[model samples]
Target: MTDIGYIHHEEHMRSSDLISDIVIGMSDGLTVPFALAAGLSGAVASSSLVVTAGIAEIVAGSIAMGLGGYLAGRTEADHYESERRREIAEVESVPEREKAEVREVFAGMGISPALQTAIADELAKDKVKWVDFMMKYELGLDEPDPNRATKSALTIGLSYVFGGLIPLSPYLLVSHPHEALLYSCIVTLICLFVFGYFKSQVTGQPPVSGAFKVMFIGALAASAAFGVARLFG
Candidate 1:
């Protein structure tokens, strides 16, 4: 079929980029700040200290997490570029070897030797297409979006700030640390459960189980921190 005659199906699907950012940012954001607040509440009588410490942690965590995400994105792009260059060199310097490699891929896929040779020959004629094909099928690498690093950094940082606010919001209203913590626990646990449910739905897992699991983890972290702080205090 002609290119114009073919229907593009990609428009129907959604990108998982934003979801990934939210997951990374929110998971750490919720868990870390919640634990810190819980720990502080156990040790301090005033909610203001907890609020101050929580804000500091959220700011630091967001920056660190965002930087890490940005670095990861850059590393992936660099790795892909390096592999692309290597593939191009290999294709130029060792044409037969590259063709054989291409044939091997199709052969493993159950394509006949004749068809493999034909496809390899056609692929070899176009250097860019050949490298792209090798990059995907042979190396299992995709061409990342150019703005992925910046977008991922911003998404993760902002999501962290948003998630971190949930547990800390109670402290802003309540005067006592213990009272704030009680409310924070309720709010954070509910948010974690709901977040996990929707996350599981997106990832094709059981929503009920995921919700419980996430809630348990959040509770566990906060409880552990609170227990330790109380022990020392």
Candidate 2:
């Protein structure tokens, strides 16, 4: 007799909060600063000016993105807490109504009425479990981690800084803005394509198309910025 063994390893990567934060930060970081440098390159003669402006923008953008991430995390936690409190209050004041809701949850799950009542009655005896059940099943909420806000802020901010540096690095080494812009365009577009490729693989999208799409967006934004700056300058 031959037996087959099954393994449960997942093939695709799942995105976490960190991944979400990095995407938010890196996407804006790479695109915005690339466009800014392209615009400045068209308008300015000195690479020094472009480098300075890019650094300042990266710093400000990182802070703003970090703050936004922090606020979003805090809001999520607060909303979950608010819902939990309401659930707790209902469990105490109108328990029958709450239990009926539990029955409804089971009914939706194809549980028979008699079995649903028995299960609801059994589940209600433990207030903590009852409240937890409602919070998850009825309200669709999970408790937020205490450090989620801080972690999100740091992750997004750091990612923005890292991404912003890639486009700006050429300016630091070169004296002419136009020359630096050429190098920046080459490197940043490559980075964008690579980033998108990996991101697509993780999220289960078509990698080659995703890479081209990302590269196109960054190129378009930079081209538009450079064109506008050249026209205005």
Candidate 3:
């Protein structure tokens, strides 16, 4: 097992939808509860209050975020199904019109009229395939994954719980609100930077810049919340 300098392997692909769900969930999970904790810290003297409130917010936030993801997934599925049905109906009811539309598609791509007619005619022979092609190229839609709704719900909910725990962890260890806030800020800010760096890597942005950007936004939100709380308290 000593000959592994450079190996060739097939490239693996990952799902963009899952990545999007994680980004949506984790970003909010990290920021919102963090800001809330910072604000609560400024207002109260007891760490217990901050911890209790933070846990409550985390539970509520996870459920709300998960439900939102599930709804979005279901809506996407519904829209795809509706369009699919309409496409099927149109194809069945108007073969000639659909054939002409197919030719138009090829024609727009700079194919010669004769070639366009030939291709379109061949495509029109198979109603199912033609409908599928039209759905993809003309309507710009892909079939939705059947498991998308349930998967998105779980992913977003779990990610929120994980992210919310970072800032809330410090309050569990300390007795005073300010002391807990100090530790929470340190831990959460580091996690945010790391999270943003990896997120940028996946999204094809500059890692350092993205990290700073995320960190700054979180800091700004927390600072604003803390200031408001202190002023009102």
Instruction: Name the candidate that leads on TM-score.
Output: 2
> lDDT of each prediction vs. the true structure?
0.94, 0.95, 0.93
Q: How does candidate 3 score on lDDT?
A: 0.93
Candidate 2 error regions (>4 Å)? 1-4, 8-10
Q: Tell me each candidate's TM-score.
A: 0.93, 0.96, 0.92
Question: Backbone clash tally for model 2?
Answer: 0
Q: Candidate 3 lDDT, tens digit per residue, 1-95? A: 57669787886435398998898889999999999999999999999999899999999999999999999999999999999899899999998
lDDT for 148 (candidate 2): 97
lDDT per residue as tens, model 2, 101-190:
999999999999999999999999999999999999998888898899999999999999999999999999999999999999999999
Candidate 2 colliding pairs:
none
Task: Give lDDT: candidate 3, residue 103.
Answer: 87
Name the lDDT value of residue 169 in candidate 2. Answer: 98
| Model 2, C-alpha of 105: deviation from truth (Å) | 1.1
Cα error of candidate 1 at position 228, Å: 0.8
State how far residue 60 of model 1 sits from its true place (Å): 0.3
- What is the alpha-carbon lDDT of model 1 when measured against the actual structure? 0.94
TM-score of 2: 0.96
